[model samples]
Target: MDYDVIIAGGGPVGLMLAHELGLHGVSVAVLERLTEVDETIKAGAINVPTAEALDRRGLTPALKAAEERNRAEYLKFVRERFGESAGPPPPPVKFAGHFAGIWLLGDRVDENDPDLTARGSASLVSGVRQQDIEVLLEERVTALGGKILRGVEVTGIESHADGVTVRAGEHAYRCGWLVGCDGGRSLVRREAGFDFPGTPPEITGHQAIVEMEGHEQLSPGWNRTGTGVYVHGPIPGRILTVEYDGPPVDRDTPITAEELQASLRNVSGADVKVTGVRSATRFTDNARQATTYRLGRVLLAGDAAHVHSPFGGQGLNLGIGDAVNLGWKLAAVAQGRAGEALLDTYTAERHPIGAWVLDWTRAQVLLMRPEPRALAMRGIVSDLIDTVTGTTYFVKRISGVWQRYDLPGDHSLVGTIVPGLEFADGSRPADHLHDGRGVLFDLGAAPETGGRVRRVTAACPDRPDLGGLLVRPDGVVAWATDASGGESPERALDTWFPPDRR
Candidate 1:
């Protein structure tokens, strides 16, 4: 076999998966037809959940630096709630302010508060450009001994029981599995016979990276007009503009300078001269997702599995998530340390979420439109809606923290997902993944009975309730019980990760 795993696209998602697999010492290779260049594509937008995923993987320092302004892209998250002296409000109200629980709080009201920086998930999310993120990922993957072959395209793919075969540059390589992170037009997905079904992006949007000298009217936190949405002030001077209506854009073709200039003129109402064209891409809000994330030995992730509107800036964020979700599972399966059943969870957990992304982005295509009718309706809703809780709930859901596979019914407290915690490992005490070992977190200091479960003292004061949690390598809690270890934790553990040879 040429490699254990071959990622067809070298975009953010592909690079992230490669990096994740590299962490587990997995033999992986990434094949890309496009020669990576220094261009700012995805205007830095790291949502809360994505930042958390990076943090859990111990990549917080690198990702945090990439978050340029360190703040969310919304006003305030509003919900339908009745105050002590008022009646029930409508859906969440979004304003140009920093308020959690609501989704649409993009602009910075104040930059002094650390929490307002949107630095972390469960707290806030900062923005990061796609180009910078890709650069970081490429470095990490290469550092981890993973092979990245740029300008190499896959002309053909053939699958067999033993392994899958990929033909790239007159060479036939075999691998236990083939993954398609190849973007919307995935050659691997096509070769694997996985169908990509959904709506194509309808609205035109463009993003470019530039070191802002200064902008006069971009203040008052986040600024918006009927032509487009201009988000500003996470960083003192940096700004991001979303143009819904502009010149026709073709993804397969190189974006043109004229198209960008025209879009800026029509949307921003001013011809803003950019210092440097770091990177530019023209794509509409498309709502398409792969029917199945997995087909036999082939699996799909990121843009390969799902493609949607970037209004939520979830395209890159969600793609990174797919990598984290599947990386450990792939590593375990390849090392024979996991059962085949473990592989099925990848699709089971991610496919539904992918579908949800398409649905939500499709909605944004309408919700965020700058049309007079849409604007008037939003304004009315904003006024009628006094409570911001509903909107906050919706935004939080879209933020991806609401995505939980191991639900309450799926397992007990120990079987749920445990937030990253600090623990001591005997002689050498340190903080690592709450997962990785797939051991159920026995926070109760479950006595040293001869068993497969590893009990550790939960040093995190915030999650005292999760002290006796049993965690899986994929970071899902398998079981949660009292300090007295009896049958429930053991049963959940047996079902999750069983010890045979030991």
Candidate 2:
């Protein structure tokens, strides 16, 4: 085998998975069609779960630096737009996120919510572009000694009982497992014969950064118009328009300045004339998901597994979650620490979340429709989103703090991402997970077991009732117990780590 794992597509998800696999000492390689990272404008920010995932990998400093840079750019944009009249930029508003076109103010978010508070520093959204994330992951992957082969497009695959052969033209690369992290139109998924079924697109959307005439005619921020929805600014010259006319006739064709101008006119009802386009892309509300994430030795993640509209900026976050969830499990299997049955859990856990994301984006598409009923519904949703409770609820959903896997064991924290609890030694749990191993936190008297799992004896003053926690490498609380009595970690340990069979 050329590698234990061969990842198709060197996008953010692929690189992240490569990093995880490499951290576990698994031989891995990432095949990317592009020689260099594309500067195409994609997701502009990451949700809380994604932030937490990066933090667990000890990439918090990088994330913070990127966030600060984005904040500075945003402040500059604000000052330029306000032009000295807005009183020193008003200290840069903390944005939580948005639902459809409705903005969820960060100030309105319930910070005291148990779920939000538990996430620690990861609770806030980080304004980092998709390109930046790919760069970061690529660096990490390279540092871990993972190979990234660029300009190698996967054309076909032949899956055997033990391994798979990936064909890129005349060359063949063999690996024990193959993961398709390619985009929505994935060749790996097609070759592997994964059933992709979902609703077709109803609306066409255009996002672009451009130089235009009469741009001031369009209002700033997300505006719901009679035609559709259009956003003017937050970033200078960045415009987004949605129209329920149908998906783009040809997505591959480059977006022309005239085309964007016409779209701006249609959605914003403004006489805006786009003079030049710096960058542009077309998208649709075409929601789809694989019937299952795996097909024998070949698996899927990121846009390969599921796809939906970019509503609420969920695409990157969803893809990041997929990488984080699949990475450790795949590493375990490749290293012979677990059986093939463990891979089944990947589909069981991620498929539902993928389905939810599809539905969530579909709902937003419904709200953004130009029809009368949709307008009424949009008004109602907007009203609901105005209240503090509504803002908090939307923040939870958009931030990904509400996601909890359906794992066994009745402990409340089970199946949830273990809180970023600070131990008595002043080190946090995330600090311990950087080595790519599961951790057993012994808050109270808990039996110590050895395998791949690391047991740490520490007291968490915040929750004295919590005796111990068995956290997976991916950060999910596999099992938990109270100081007095709770389910034993034997079941989870045996299920996930199992004594290494040498």
Query: Candidates' TM-scores?
Result: 0.78, 0.97
lDDT of model 1, residue 348: 78
The sequence of per-residue lDDT tens digits that candidate 2 reaches over residues 130-209 is: 98898899999999999999999999999999999999888999999999999999999999999999999888899998
Model 2, which residues run further than 4 Å from truth?
84-95, 106-108
Question: Using lDDT as the measure, which candidate wins?
Answer: 2
lDDT of 1 by residue, 1-502 (tens): 8788988888888898888788878899999888874454454566655666655655666766655333322211111111134332342222222221113543312233322232333234355667767887798889899999999898888889877999997988888888888887778888788877786555666665443332342332334567776554333333455666543544667655555555555665764554445556666766777777888888999987887766666688788878878987788777676676877878877887777777766665565677787766666545433344534444455545456664343324433245544444421111245234555445664444246655555444544544366665555556555443444555665555556422
TM-score of 1: 0.78
TM-score of 2: 0.97
